[model samples]
Target chain A: MPCRMTSLHQLLASVLMMAGLVGPAAAEDPNGARRKALHNMVVQDCGSCHGLTFKGGLGSPLLPDDLEGVDDSTIATIVLDGVPGTPMPPWRGLVSESEALWIARGLKAGVFQ
Target chain B: MNLLRGLTVLIATAVWCLTAAADTALRGTGDLGVIIERADGSACIISTTERAILSCVDGLGDLSHASAVFSPDQRYAYIFGRDGGLTKLDLLERKIAKRVIQGGNSIGGAISDDGTLVAVSNYKPGGVKVFDATTLEQIADIPATYGSEGKLSKTVGLVDAPGRRFVFTLYDAGEIWMADFSKPGAPAITKLGTAGKLPYDALITGDGRHYIAGLFGEDGLAHVDLWAEEPVIERILDGYGKDDPAMPVYKMPHLEGWALAGDKFILPAVGHPELLALDAVTFKEAGRVKVHSQPVFAIARPDGRQVWVNFAHPKNDTVQVVDVPSLKVVHEFKPGPAVLHMEFTPRGHEVWVSVRDADRVDIYDARSFEKRGELSLRKPSGIFFAARATRTGL
Candidate 1:
């Protein structure tokens, strides 16, 4: 069972790496618990203003279709810096750059949808 | 022939017994309430007396930031959804009596003093829409237009006031307006004047005498005395938290849960791990208590002896209880991950807390702080009791 689990993890890691969704640092801990924490933050914290379904609320809609034209880097920057003159607060210290990118990719991919 | 008659009688008796079991005995809803299951877009009708969920009503859309208001009779609940859905839920039947997509995106709602109208605050179209409580028909639409450009501003902090009036603030416009429905169809709007920069949410005193709005862009809160002949917006605690370096706020502090403890108002300070106390009479800074983190809700128990506080995200696992008399932290404990909201029983004996991530609602003895019971739910957020029907600005 241990050997089979190792092969499955490798297969999943390779697919994620090929998709350019993870950095080298994140790859070192592919199935880390921090990933689960980050996912919860996106759903609960970010979802507080942006709708839970990402349709729209006080914050703008963040659905996959809504973010179609936006790039992952821009999304990551917004996640870190937040939009000025609004209730969106910066998450620089709370979320790392790579994690923000991961969240951005997940958002655009409708992983949270 | 005798055998066939016996069989028919037995089947009829069994069917009657099954029907009787399906329909429980009629009971009062005074000890009943609703909990918003945010993730599933549904609400659970809970019995506070029994500390259990009676039924779950589904199909309410986008309950991410949902809130509810009860009718004068306390038999119906008006649930305001983030997707601009207003659902009128019947407590006895445990179903959505009527639902309507009133706007594109909505914040919250309030019911008229006479229970004739329900008003929704919208963000997409940026206005307030009033509807008939029973029929769910549009009564009037008041746009939150401000400035020289006549731009529409998003409305927040919508609450019902005495004499069939609704009070709310414009987020982008920095103003508060009161819609008086004395004439029913024609609403007499009174601009209460400038609130601060980005007046996010507001609350009216239990006596319905004062309306206070918390500012996001500034330090102080905007205050208005509703009892005055000509209500004017006054700024209080205008220079609060100016000495400390600003911290990034993960969750905005909600003012609707502002607590009135004894002679003071215990309010959660934005971007600060503190609860600010103001003299309820003079509106001056009375005292401040350092809490665990940025407080999301500082709610006082019914008798106003203790105030319970919950923090924002990441630090939200902890809840602290403050003694109103000494203005000190009396107790602190971790219920579970993601403690979204807390509601005290009408008499302030027991408090029901919603642990979202844990999918459970834990009931605690308000005085002893003992865990009394628990009910499993799905991502519960807000717990509104039928007792709110009697309060001024629940």
Candidate 2:
């Protein structure tokens, strides 16, 4: 435990250093007009666990086929309240109500493209 | 070259269709024995067909898609709406005498051998509805231990024992119910929790002490010793994998089409898509063999020598015959649509099946296993005959 803790501290130090180098520039990076804004935020945040493209590297993929008949309101509830007995967690406290709806709309429309 | 290839493919398809059409040769021996279907508030027996009979919509009234029970004497048919309504009809009069609202979807009912009491499993809310066979009066409505929300597919098989006693399968709570209707008021239903997944249906042995249940949710069979204080259960064959983490096929090994053959039970396995034989007393896996792909139901002859099953593909939505002794599929009958549920008429010549998706129950000739005719319904699911054939003819 002692040796593993030392190495984990080193890994955290390196991650912090990397974040310092790149963090300031990304804060104000405006989402492209072509893409919905909230959808871009979801790609950046949710992609932390789900893959960036949402094709699911660490978490399950939110594929178009998977979201087949799912609508915006259901997605909003899934995003805000989270599905019980699943890996999804409530994003309501951290995210604004408008952000959730925007992301859900984009999820539906993006599947078409 | 492309044009030539397309022409070849077209020619092949034409030949295949022609050959398939020829294979739909209707074959079977037996006529309509007795019919049971849902009526206004109960089950009714409006008509009988010796050859192949169809449900006459004009006369039977709003009795589409009901569970019909025929009397042992073949004089009356009890009809009920599996959705909560039960009824009794005089076979000769073709009119409903009594009707009552019954709750439970996928609910099943059974009549005593002497035709005095009829009990139905209220599947959704988890209760049993007992009625007087002669007058079609509600005698009792007994519920199970923990309350069950009437959302899942419950109340499937209500098998009758002598003295107005019976067993029922609960879909979600993972239990089978034992109840005796000799009581006047609320019939007390004892929970026989054969703790596995949900048990879809069951077949009681001739003596009615032991029960073999088709264990859903897993690749196995649940053998319950119903005579004991708590049913002694032996779980065999758990085949569902973990890839389906949520909404898994836990309760949908979905094997149906079972019948008791002598001291052995014959059932299809959804995992293996094959028929299995287990000892009624010992609960040991006796025989395992294949019959159809995604086979759902089966009906056996009283002799247990032959069994018929529903098998489908776009090519053959039909009934396949199995020689139970050999456990081999020997014949096929092309009935319209998919055969969801079936029961052999007492006459032995016919097997009536509810074409679930097609919204009708088609009738077939038993011996040849061929489509004799059908009964049109809105969306029928369960089926049963009044009694075993009184006199045999096709």
Candidate 3:
């Protein structure tokens, strides 16, 4: 009975790791300090062109409803690469791909607003 | 006899006290200014001489990109807010005299040469609205409609010009317009022709003879000699940055703060970490000074002896001072994280810098390069003094 129980526990651990729920790589969420810095950048730097409330100013509105039809990856790509021939500039150097993706998801979820 | 003497002394003392109170009530606003508390949506009325915040007035909504212009008498400040709030603040009363929501999104504003009209540039509905300076009542609305499609263009860089005119650039239409309010209610709008690609911001010379707009979509600037018989837009410094690979611009360079040091105009190069010097006479490139990362505001001292440059994000913490004659950076220092603005005292003896992250405004001696004093406040930006009342296009 003890041997059977140990085998079941091993199977559960493998499943969790495969799902990226419990792994070293999945733990790379921007730590607390880094997250705070990113939050400030969104409110202060991004808020310069986009209204602080994300209602829209020089830049388009960034509210969740405003970004309704756009997918997360598309938003992330625009955040990283920027739209051409516009005032929007790329953030490739300032933010990592994963971090940009995180920001994109957050924006879609109204987490930043 | 003793009672009579005591009453006489009391009367004299009362008269003296009354005189002192009257003098205090008549204090001048020459040394007073307001600093925008961006995060708190308030402004601190400060005294340059005392180096202290006198009073804070709130309820001026969404000051993320606020700018102000002083009345001719320098007693009232017309504040333009990002969320379309135009507030008339009474400096003497230390309170908001009037507030009005003029548009959906406003960029900035300008006071008329006569100080009778206040004009604002809007982005959302895309137009310029002029208001009665005293009553805060809408007088005229000039839509920035352009192209065959009749699309409204975002108006930027509105400045008060001589002859009771307001000059501004249309971002989407790539054109400049001058609204002459000489006739008051009926403004004569003149299409000043194409300003290359996207004219983001502009500045008028201290003499108000030249209007120069910086282009964003291309590496050039649009210049208009307002004194010309038939003023025409001329592209200057076209393709100046073609040789260099473009870098991401975290913040757009502010042309309103373009420096006029000596005979050269010190301007922040778009998307590059350099300050381009243009001859104030011919408007030709004279030199370039490479400095810390992407320069935002390159403002000259009031005496035009030194130019101070501040940078954009990542490098935004630093400030560099360049001596005009040598075109060389003389001093570099970090005021603190997120140094948003620098305002020189009316005489240029000292500079007040707003350190946003630190929630403090630091005063430094312009010549000695030493810290003078600091005042704690909320996240502050854009420090404007009453001295702007006499200057052109602050």
Candidate 4:
């Protein structure tokens, strides 16, 4: 009875989220088309140096394992203000703070795929 | 008993010597080809004479932006991996002869004109390290640091020119320096100041007269005449992209793939879906051809009649072939998803293209534009030929 009740609750939550009734924060990305484009950029453009599969290449790995100790804020900072004296160029001019934060969180959650 | 034992030892020695002599005879210029693969960092030693793939060897690490420089004889190939692994592979044995981790990160490398020295451009330590070509021993180290502050800068556009000089651009320093190795000991450094804001990549003219550096921070390119008495730096295509809004550059385009067809130089316009034609003699823009997306490589055919161009991600599947004379896109084809590289055979009879997402390399007849054959590979990218050894700055 308890398991059934938990399943019902989870199903209701998913339905609400899909219906845009829950998670109002997701609506912050005003343009759905722009968000899709950014997601593709994260996968393909970032994939250039970080490996197509997001394993690692000329740049370090962005997988959850490699980014374990690094927090989302620190990751966001590095993405916005790149590390100096390195091949990583500054993306602050191109990536906004909100978009950078979204990228960092997504990378931490292994969303590159 | 002593006589019998002596005879057996003599027989064994004779057989070993005969096998060694046979191997030496089989290894020649005829048995030369290059196989570039990124399926877990490995290469297949190809036999050009037989026109077939030979042996596949493993252990090349992190092959993103990977490149190989062949020896003068084309017997040994020095593969530079993205992880700073410099592996010397012997084509005869189909194995790695020697390997060393020169730095924590490396972009690419070049070999001296005489084939005596091998130099690598590093990203981690931000310098150029030269090694003995045969022995793979470190010979010299030149850190890319300038100004009174001694700040180290990431090096790019590393290439070897005539007169025993190695030239490269410093990203952070915004300068170009030539390391003259004509004399012994430390190389004489000539710092040609401030090439541009960000010189991403560069290539020497096929004639080996000019070294052009592509700028990322600005609209123009920095041009240096290697043979000039003072080697003055000139900027070309000034205000090329000044009027246009910046497009999202998913991957940086390499200027090394810029093609020189007759009097014209076919180059990708930065952050633009167009390919610009520059006059090789005047170093000025001649014309432009619109393409599918931002061009990655504008490679010219051997006869210099046409240029085959590929685009950056999203539009990578499409390839446009431009007729040099008219400066028009003559043909457009979609080979497959994630097209990575294209290479023409020595005589430009057959052109090979790598379709990474499709797991096949398509070979097309140069003139008729018909599919000839295909080679199955795992995540294939660059298709280098043994003929590259005959040229400079490959």
Candidate 5:
């Protein structure tokens, strides 16, 4: 069972890496709990303003096509600093820089749709 | 005799099928309710007959916010969408009666005290628009123009007060205005300036005596006494969040959900992880009940014994039920990943909670805090019951 679970994890990592949803370095972190929590935050919390499907409700869409040509750093900055004069509030206190980058990458890669 | 027996069996079968079909149709007169399917941009009318789930009628509006005001007879629902689309939905027919683009961006609206007028507070045109409830025809347009430049500011926290008046706060301008339609033709406007900085939301008391607005640019709330002839304005809960620094506010704390549990008002504290209880009559601080995270909706059960609170994001999964008298957290449960809104049965025996991420609505015993049942839904956000039909400010 342990061997089968390890193989499944490896397969998931390979697929995510190929799809650019996760970088190779971050995949080695072995923080499944954090990833799950962040996934929940991106889909449920961020999904409040952005639609649950990330198709844009009050905020703009976070779909991969909508985020085309938007760099990782810019996305990360928006996640941390937020857009002023808008409903989008900053997430710096809630998420760390690396976690924000992970969310940005996942959003850009259409990981949460 | 055999032929008669056959006819009887056929009649029994037909009666059985008819009964089953009637059970599905379930909705009796005045039992229709609407649930906000935010993702689908539609409001699903569920039959509150036996708390049964029905079907959704589509094409409500673009990015439909959780703002729905029912008609006086509880037949039509006035929904204000985020993209400035105001659609009137008929609950009985389960169809959109009329829709209009009242502004470029809008938040929420209110129905008049007499229920003859429906008013919408706008974010784009920065004003309030009043329409006839029956025809959906525009009657009055009052802009929230500020200062010498006459620059408009987004209007928020709109509530229908007594005496045919709609009271709201100008968000950017930090002022509260009341438009009285009592005399007809044109609405007489009264502006109370310098209420505070950046008033985000406002709420009027059930008696329509006090109109309070929560300020986002400042640390306190502005309370206006509407019954007074001169209309005295006072700031309550001053320096409530002055010591705390600004944090990431994922969702703005809603003042509308501030619960009136008996004489005490249970409000979600801004920039803090606590629920502030204040004396409803005096507007003085009563007690503070600390919760899991920044509380969004701190609503009281109908009996006013317990206050159920759903927090802002990151901790939105957990709902804490606070004992009103003791001011303690009694029962806390993690409903799902994204718990959006909750509504109690008319008597407050059952609380129907919408778990958005779970794609279901869970019914819980309000007293025991036990899960009773669950129903499958699609991204349900707000669960508004038909009991709001008789209430003044829901």
Candidate 6:
């Protein structure tokens, strides 16, 4: 295996930044609860297995750094199309485009309901 | 006809919804490509060569060094401590759900062989947080010292004891603690006499009366008699002696990695740097195996034939191989630098090695020691693998 020296904390922070949830927690949304609700839905519904608080459980840690900068459209595709060859099943028919956006934005906001 | 068709549409949507949720819940890290168990009950190997991170419970404070082994029971991997912090990873929805910060930088943790209790090693403030495996709710907090020790300094390992209290050792400090939780609130801790120098990790024999720790400051391993009112240190390894290397700067000898094999204690030495066998009873040297020139971790494989070692590897990388019965190096390779920790899955099939400096995890086949898959993650330390979670039964 290739020996690569790296700091996990720095690497994780960077991944979160790339995910677009970086930079001072997104200015603390004026409608915090509403946004949190959206985020919380993902946790309550999805977290039943993954984890309630973020970072992980049955699911993987969806750090903000990984989701940042990607357009909502792509996020929608991931939810709708789903990543294959893994456990992630597609949410296409079950979730509407807007619903995926809600989860994406909640993911972006970094606050769970 | 219209109503019937409408019902069919609703049913189709429901089925898709269930599949979607199940699949999403079962989503693969999809990135690592490692074989996390597939839907068919067969193993599916991922193409990547990086190993996966095995974080038990990751603490927030300096005790973050404290970690617990995580199970795939859809629960958070908690960093053990007095009030430990929980590591929340949701593999299904594919994201970190949330971090439930708890208390204490407790030491080692044990999930009953059947994965029932998350037994945490509470050091100073000695106690174990018995949480409902599935609910994450604190069911019982069993303590050693009859609940007297301050708090363990993030260096304890716990083992399962049916009739007696589970056993644990305070690695940095010098003490082995045992407490029975079968009755809960009134758990009594038996503090064995301090044995060995800076006694760290220890193991209780199958009978549960004998305990031993690899002494860091001392010359060899020490034996603790758990059956006695106060545990007694009855044994030491005649491996090598600490000597002055002429220069004023002392080359202090240290010891680590003491594993259990049948009824014998397989202890490794620092000076001679050899793997020596100790007769648990007479506390006499039973046999010796001259191991790595710079032997550090002399981890004996379960079969008692091969002791895997990282004697030589690149700087910050680990070069490991299985030392067979004849003391021959079976499989060898440079998995990565600073191969800090090596753990084999229960079945002894996959050897998950973590390259702390490499910021990567590498998985290899135990038999072949061939690189099977890999995980490219940020700071992939304390790597762990839960029984593969699949995209079904959402």
Which parts of model 3 have CA positions greater than 4 angstroms off?
A1-26, B1-24
Poorest stretch of ten by lDDT in candidate 3 chain B: B18-27
TM-score of each: 0.91, 0.59, 0.90, 0.80, 0.83, 0.54
What DockQ does predicted model 3 obtain? Answer: 0.56
lDDT of 4: 0.78
Model 2 misplacement above 4 A? A1-113, B1-49, B52-66, B104-106, B147-154, B183-188, B226-231, B236-258, B312-316, B345-365, B368-383, B388-394
Residue range with the least summed lDDT across 10 consecutive positions in model 1 chain A: A23-32
Question: Model 1 - which docking category?
Answer: medium
Q: Candidate 1's residue-wise lDDT over B1-394, tens digit each?
A: 9999999999999999975774577678899999999999999999999888889999999899999999988999999998999999999899999999999899988888788999999998998999999999999999999999999999999998999999999999999999999884599999999998988899987888889999998999999999999999999988889987667788888876347889999999988899999999999999899999999999999899999999998799899999998999999999999999999999999999999999999999999999999999998999999989888888
Cα lDDT of model 4 by residue, B1-394, tens digit: 9999999999999999986785567657534566667646877766544445667788988676678888988888888877788999888887999999998777788888889999999877778999999998999999998779987777888888887778888866778888989999988989987888877788887557788888777788888987788998999988887777756554577876337888898888877888888898899999889889999888889888999988887678988899999999989999998788887887788788888768778888888899888777777777777677767887
- Give a tens-digit lDDT track for model 6, residues B10-71: 99999999867755553434332222211111112222223433222222332222344444
Q: Give one digit per residue, the lDDT tens place, for model 2 in A4-103.
A: 6645654554344334442224333223452343443465335433433344422355645456698767887878886553335566765565556555
TM-score between candidate 3 chain A and the true chain A: 0.74
lDDT of 3 at B187: 97
Candidates 2 and 6 compared by TM-score, better number:
2
- How well does candidate 3 score on lDDT at residue B196? 85
TM-score, chain A only, candidate 2, equals: 0.55
lDDT by residue for model 3 (B235-289), tens? 9888889989878888888987347788998988999888988998998999899
For candidate 6, the per-residue lDDT at B54 reads 26
| Candidate whose lDDT is highest | 1
Candidate 5 stretches with Cα past 4 Å from truth are A1-18, A21-44, A47-75, A83-88, A93-113, B1-30
Off by over 4 Å in 1: A1-32, B1-22
**Once superposed on the true structure, which residue ranges of model 4 sit more than 4 Å away at CA?**
A1-45, A51-106, A109-113, B1-32, B47-51
Q: What's the C-alpha lDDT at position A42 in model 4?
A: 73
Give the top-scoring candidate (DockQ). 1
Question: B178, model 2: CA deviation in Å?
Answer: 1.3
Arrange candidates by TM-score, highest first: which order?
1, 3, 5, 4, 2, 6
- How close to the true structure is residue B136 of candidate 5, measured as C-alpha lDDT? 86
B203-255 per-residue lDDT for model 5 (tens digits): 87777877888777677888888988878679898888777775567887777
